[model samples]
Target: MRARFIFSALATTLIGTAPALAQDDLSVDQVLGAWQKQKQIFHEAQSSGLGQTRGLKLIAVEGVDAAETAPQQGVSVTASTDAPTSTDTTPMDPNKPLVAATATTTTTTAPLVFGQLDPELQVNLQIKFGFDSAALADDQKPRLDKICQAMKLSDVQLFRIVGHTDTAGTDTYNERLSVLRAKEVARYLVEDCNITASRLETLGLGERFPLNQDDPRADENRRVEFQALS
Candidate 1:
């Protein structure tokens, strides 16, 4: 009952925004074979003269050059600087990603940026959260249990749990809700499923990549997706 109310309340509310990343992104031990093959499509689109023809933009938070937009109109700044730590206390730009002119990969080479990650990479889980709520819905334990069991296998190494939402609220509201839900789900896996925290990474893309773009209000669009990311 509470979940239903919370879900309905979401339509009128707005959530705050945070940095693009929730925490330090640790390097993956090994990239999954399937993911690598899927990633190849992105690389081809990048190298081809036609450019990232899929309308995808290169976005980075902080793995290489930390570029930020200035408050002044049309003013932007780019520089080679170290990624800031959580403990660093200083007035800085808000946690919006710096856009790059062209498509480029991150970390060991260029800055960490978004790639044309296939939507199929996102696993459809019945994970749902209410507005301004981080608590995982009580339903769908059997489905979640099967996912947890898969992660426990030896062959599977590291994975990412991503949160998404339907087009019901402000982008900021949905983004934060997604993050909170993803973090909470990660917490459950670590504490309840006995999975190592280091092996699981979490992120929230909000409503950017909905499963049912045609019907934005679809419940399946509001979900947590698990992908074997390296």
Candidate 2:
């Protein structure tokens, strides 16, 4: 119930609705493209005075000619006659741009940014299980394989395997069933796909989140989903 309420609230709050991601099959390129766009938007929002800004006076390294790069507008840099010696003990790589810090100056530094994909991206897979059993169906293994392939290709390192069930049994029974199904999927991913166990978490939302809310008993309501953690 809580999960359903939260998701519904989020749907209402997010800017204009994003199209739902296709649930038929996993596509690595499509997922990555969406993530990249979201990441850019997240960073731009962070850079707008929301993150910490520190003005830094970049100094030239000794014997290294400093190539001047103009800072963003509204930012100013000042140099001091009493220049501090470079303390960077590490060997310099020729390919890297060189800069020395001398004093405290306020400059806009992008905040530590971590972006989450739009909720519409939560992948809904038709993972089947034997009747009244949590055991995964043999024929449905390929569906899980597709998910593994997508995850390996994606930059996301952690994922949550969320389980749901159709509204058929009691809430308690459905919840337990959902959890067992999710755990089975996670176990398969770890053992069969060589996915790190630590990188996966399982959640049993049970019938709390239904794809076809209008018809709670719809087969589509009984589904497994992938949510990126990081």
Candidate 3:
């Protein structure tokens, strides 16, 4: 009973001292104000020439206010000095080709109709087709030999093979016939002269672009020609 009485008295004394200790402690606002005053005094001393070098070392006095240094509302502020890294979770396939994750595509402007050729460099093939047929006649095949020879001799890299037709059939029929004729010439050049098919582009201008503008039905209007692109 005597020991319990002594322990209760010690506890009462500690509880009473706790409020007094808290009352003596500085608050956050008070600590900040004290720091601001120190800063002001340092600046004043410097401006007044009181802080001149007199062959003496300058010492900075630092003090910590327990209230300010203490954790406020159980929150902490810490700084991270390390750089962040990317963590991509995507799985890689060994069989598939590896490429950049982000790709950018660039679009180029297309060339004008008939791949627009220089009129001065135009080669008139004069290869004619049978009436109402896209098939090349036996006599017309020989004319392509000259074209293949010119292509081989010239430094041109690419050519546009354009097919034309006389105004004898409907627009649809003439268009189809002209396309077929252009493809036929391109095929012949590829097979006979060993020209790359990629180097040639076929276009069909049915009665639209003609050498003989005076008469649409003229045999001279029904022809195929080559135009250098590059």
Best by lDDT: 2
Candidate 1 matches the true fold with a TM-score of 0.53
Error of 2 at 154 (Å): 2.1
> Per-residue alpha-carbon lDDT of model 3 for 1-230, expressed as tens digits?
00000001111110111110110133334323332433343334345443432211122211211121111111111112232112321332323222111112232232221222222223455665555455555677776665666566654455556677888888767765676567667766776687766566555667665556567787767777654434
Which scores greater on TM-score, model 2 or model 3?
Answer: 2
Q: List the candidate numbers ranked by TM-score, top first.
A: 2, 1, 3
Best by TM-score: 2
Model 2 lDDT tens row, 88-164: 22322323322232223343332211122344644677777766556655688877766777667776655656678
Kindly report which residue stretches of model 1 are placed more than 4 angstroms away from their true locations once superposed. Answer: 1-112, 119-121
Ranking by lDDT: 2, 1, 3
* Weakest ten-residue segment in model 1 by summed lDDT: 1-10
Q: Give me the runs in candidate 2 sitting further than 4 Å from their true place.
A: 1-22, 34-119
The 0-to-1 C-alpha lDDT of every candidate, in the order given, reads 0.46, 0.50, 0.44
